[model samples]
Target: MQDGTTVRDVMHRAFLGVSESDTLGDAAELMLAEGADCLVVVRGGEPVGCLSPRDALGAILDGADPGETTVDEVMAPPAPTVPADSRIAAAEERLVAEGSSRLVVTRDGEAVGILTERDVLAAGTTHPSAGAEHAVRGSAADVGAAEEAAVDAESADAPTAEATQSICEVCGTLTAELSPSNGQMLCPDCQEV
Candidate 1:
């Protein structure tokens, strides 16, 4: 999902917005009407939190009246922000560190888009830079799998067994975690200029 793919490349440029003071019923209705999986909760025109479908569902199942509950009461805290220029891999790391499934993409501290787990998964399936993605992940098995898939899609020749089983030649930090680069196998860390 990475490999030079910036947050801007995969983030949703258009996201639905909801007011923090709005009734949960109203927010849920808006989500349904817009076919939105999540909504940006706002207060005074500023983003305050994120409202995912799970949040709404939990409130409903808890016997809370959506009409009486406010979005703030059910919404998760504000999502972590990543600059639009940030790498998807870094953003993915932040998502894990924050234990959040979504990230708010911003530029100059102003929200410009949103990135979700779904978007990352979609990119992984369609992105052509699979080898690079796996290299960054530091796993030979992953690199081999991604390479095999790429070769099959393009009908390229199969790589040597060593390519899939070797460690980084430049840095011994990883075992069986090298990717071909300029005819040499190197870990992503070593590939950095």
Candidate 2:
């Protein structure tokens, strides 16, 4: 059942984004001033990561020296992105798989728009599964599949956040709890390189 609606058709044209080198405080300030919850981070003219209010709060709570911290330090990495022409259903699937709330819509590798779960619901896009459709129609599997899907969609629709694994040159760990630097995963000890 193709509705012939592209993500570009439904994406928000005006999105607030940031750069990787920006300070945490700066990113937060921008987000607040712009009335945005998330700030997209870019590098080499490409969508990279996103900084959310949650991320800023976590960094602050962790005693991160705001002046020394950069968006690259806290911005979520491996940002799940979608082509401008992507099908709404495909976008919905990625939103579930990546556990993100927004998706950066790109054209020729350049970000053009953003799609959020709320945006999807507001547009009345059908839920992904039969269970979801039933839930939306108020069927009591009491399962609330649609609600769950909404949650998943909201998170998935967002750009990718930091990954849990990285490649460590020192410990020879191909994928371990590590931080992101310019989209490459580096273990805590190997981050200096």
Clashes of 2: 16
Candidate 1 wrongly placed segments (more than 4 Å): 1-4, 121-193
Q: Could you tell me which residue pairs clash in candidate 1?
A: none
Candidate 1 displacement at residue 148 in angstroms: 8.8
Estimate, for each residue in 1-193, the C-alpha lDDT of model 2 and write its tens digit: 3478778878898888788988998888888898887788888659888888879988989998778899899887746889989887677667656655678889999888898754554444565432334223323222245545555654565545333322343433323356667666466545755
Point out where model 2 deviates above 4 Å.
Answer: 127-193
Worst lDDT window (10 residues) for model 2? 134-143
Relative to the unseen true structure, what is the C-alpha lDDT of residue 70 in candidate 2, on a scale of 0 to 100? 91
